[model samples]
Target: MMALYNGDEKDIREFFRVYCNFFKEQGYDVVTFEACIGMIMPGAGALGDSRVIPVIQEEDDFRNYPWDDIPELYFKEYSKYFRALREEMPEGMKAIGGVGNGIFECVQDLTSFQGLCYIAADDEELYHNLFKK
Candidate 1:
């Protein structure tokens, strides 16, 4: 399985081409393409800055976070790559959808692993609300 981060359509297509070819050369019969739905909160990997590590500084930050206001560009770019990949998919290959971070995982991303434990104990309501969002 290979996961692709956000990029222009051209770059994404080129990557798929190379990726499929490499696997074919290695005698693999199938390839999986993975892409994420944009997350509401930031984290250490993929969606957030690697240098900064954790994007959310505090638990309170989650209270008023914009859960549904993802920018148009995210979906636009994602659709572009998704369509391209499907159109360019090689014969006998299968495509798989990538589910981004789940409720628990997103919370861990917003708060660190340690912080999540603290929040879960400190406010059960807030923890549940996180999942509700």
Candidate 2:
């Protein structure tokens, strides 16, 4: 899956062309594609379960985190893949995908699952606010 994110425009196009064919061979008219948003997060590897430390451990950590730039970061990192999928899809086939993980997963990626649970128990507001953001 990470392979789809590398290379220049021509490489991306070739990747998607082959990907779309793979789905077709499986007797499907649609292909699934998703960009991992967690990769764009400030400190991320937890999403891939690398056991790295969490980025948000306390209120100050959350406050200092760059909450506003995720979208741009995502586009910068993955928009080309989406464009390639669009341009390379076979005429009768379509692709369905968006960001790889949902809010809960993203939160857990930022704060370890245990840490999030602790926050929920100790700082209910912050726990809820994490989801709100």
Candidate 3:
């Protein structure tokens, strides 16, 4: 099995390295898709401007940060970035896309972890709603 990401190469490689190292510690050899395609910096989005307070840094440094306060352009640019990444994936490899068991992490990134746990426990409908969104 191989894992690939659409973000910074260092973070992606670190994730894969830790993933493989954990499995290898128990005896297994794995090849990551990033390793298959020699990457160094990868790509990142610039969804900040004067109107927006550069929520990316806040989102990265803080949890349960209010993203609803961000401008719609930020989300629009981010969605465009994601769409571009989706389009860039090899057609044969589309079916393999996902964070494996990290669905909750994806949700947290989309929403927030504190909100996610509440939705997971108190509002299944809203949880799935945000998840599909």
Candidate 4:
């Protein structure tokens, strides 16, 4: 959650300035930041050592996923961070940032690596549809 939250935008711009300036003062030309997709996912611990349960083990799981809400959820959770990063970049400095997990990583996170391997064999269409989602 902290990764997605940059605090309240109006209240956090000053902190953003401070954050970017620290790296600039340290002789860095760019600051790096990212927001992970797992924040919005319902069951997403597959990326770490937590329980390896997968969210999309079947076609029904994929079909039932709230795909339409993802964009809105992402915007609400992370757009301000990107805006702040751009606005707060130091002079002569740039930023490196990523919005969320890529398709591969997201799918892997939604389905544990082992689960993905099973999906590949057990249900090819469901596996493909998971990615299509």
Best by lDDT: 2
lDDT of candidate 4?
0.80
Look at candidate 4 and give me any clashing residue pairs.
none
Model 2 stretches astray by more than 4 angstroms = 47-51
User: lDDT by residue for model 2 over 1-133, one digit each (tens)?
Assistant: 7666568899899998898989989999899999878878988655457478889888888899999999999999888889888988888988888898899889989988888889999998889889999
Sort the candidates on lDDT, descending order.
Answer: 2, 4, 1, 3
Report residue 46 deviation for candidate 4 (angstroms): 3.3
- N/CA/C clash count, model 1: 0
Ten contiguous residues minimizing lDDT sum, candidate 3:
36-45
After best superposition, candidate 4 residue 3: deviation in angstroms? 7.6
Go through the candidates in order and give each one's C-alpha lDDT. Answer: 0.60, 0.86, 0.39, 0.80
* True-structure lDDT of candidate 1: 0.60
Compute each candidate's TM-score over C-alphas. Answer: 0.64, 0.89, 0.27, 0.78
Off by over 4 Å in 4: 1-11, 49-52
lDDT of 4 by residue, 25-124 (tens): 8999888777887778777778664387788788888888788887788888777877887898888998887766788888888888888899999999
Candidate closer to the true structure by lDDT (higher is better), 1 or 4: 4
lDDT (10s digit) by residue, model 1, range 1-133: 3345545668778877887777667877776655444342334342243344444444566655665554454465466666776766778876665445565665566656665566678877766776677
User: How close to the true structure is residue 128 of candidate 2, measured as C-alpha lDDT?
Assistant: 85
What residue pairs clash in candidate 2, if any at all?
none
Give candidate 4's TM-score.
Answer: 0.78
